[model samples]
Target: MPVAALDDIRAKVGQQVGTSDWIEVTQDRISAFADATEDHQFIHVDPVAAAAAGFGGTIAHGFLNLSLLSRMAADAMLVPDTTRMALNYGLDRVRFIAPVKAGKRVRGHFTLDGVDEKAPGQLLIRQTVTVEIEGEEKPALTAQWLGLIFT
Candidate 1:
């Protein structure tokens, strides 16, 4: 991961920092998530049942979409040049505004919301993120994500 100085990161507050690459939401991937999480709701694992239920086909789980933010951040989030490591501090707010159906592609748009120097060599960064579904006006989810960077 390329790194940026703390001051450099802070300079872009309230501005979009990066956008991640698109990731296809395949049924196989959805099924794997279901198996791993034991969230085998038919709407996520059964295409027929999901279609009958009016979702058109299997829709990925909300959590599944949320979990992808970490992967998305690898490409979209900035890392302070002086940092030794960064941790997922948590999310402030999250909303699932749209369903991501199988075969759809999604990517994250990240904006630097805020940056706080909690202490020397420790920084708390907040980002506003939107997980956009391909060809859709509404995003799959939006969140206020936080990270703790240790320099």
Candidate 2:
């Protein structure tokens, strides 16, 4: 992780900050996500059944892919040292553009969309994140993610 000054972070607005390394979406991962979320949909857990459903094989749940944004951000995004901690604020918008089937690789491209001071010590950080599925033309999803960092 890199600690950046507040002023330096402000300068990165509207620009891509970083991209995370590729992460393989394996069956185990999908299963784990499903178990954790109690979303054991057939398409997400049964390969044979999912194969017949036109997905070719079991596909990761859209929410499963969406939940990975945090790990992706932690891998590549820089945080200011003045910030004590960060919290998930909310998403302005999110779209599932494509399916993330099992055995595919994915990574996130993080862009600093905007930043605003929510209060005296907390700031709202807005970011536009694109989760790109490797070897695929279309992305898995795009979301306007928000976070509140307390200084």
Q: Please give the range of 10 consecutive residues that has the lowest summed lDDT in model 2.
A: 74-83
Clashing pairs in 2: none
Query: Residue 60 lDDT in model 2?
Result: 94
Cα lDDT over the full model 1: 0.93
TM, every model? 0.97, 0.95
Q: Report the lDDT tens digits of candidate 1 across residue range 19-67.
A: 9999999999999999999999999998999999999999999999999
Q: How far is candidate 2 from the true structure (C-alpha RMSD, Å)?
A: 1.1
C-alpha lDDT score of every prediction, in listed order: 0.93, 0.92
Query: What's the CA RMSD for each of the models?
Result: 0.9, 1.1
Candidate 1: worst-modelled 10 consecutive residues by lDDT: 1-10
The positional error of residue 27 in candidate 1, measured at the CA in angstroms, is 0.5
lDDT of candidate 2 over 24-103, digit per residue (tens) = 99999999999999999999999999999999999999998999898898877767789899999989999999999999
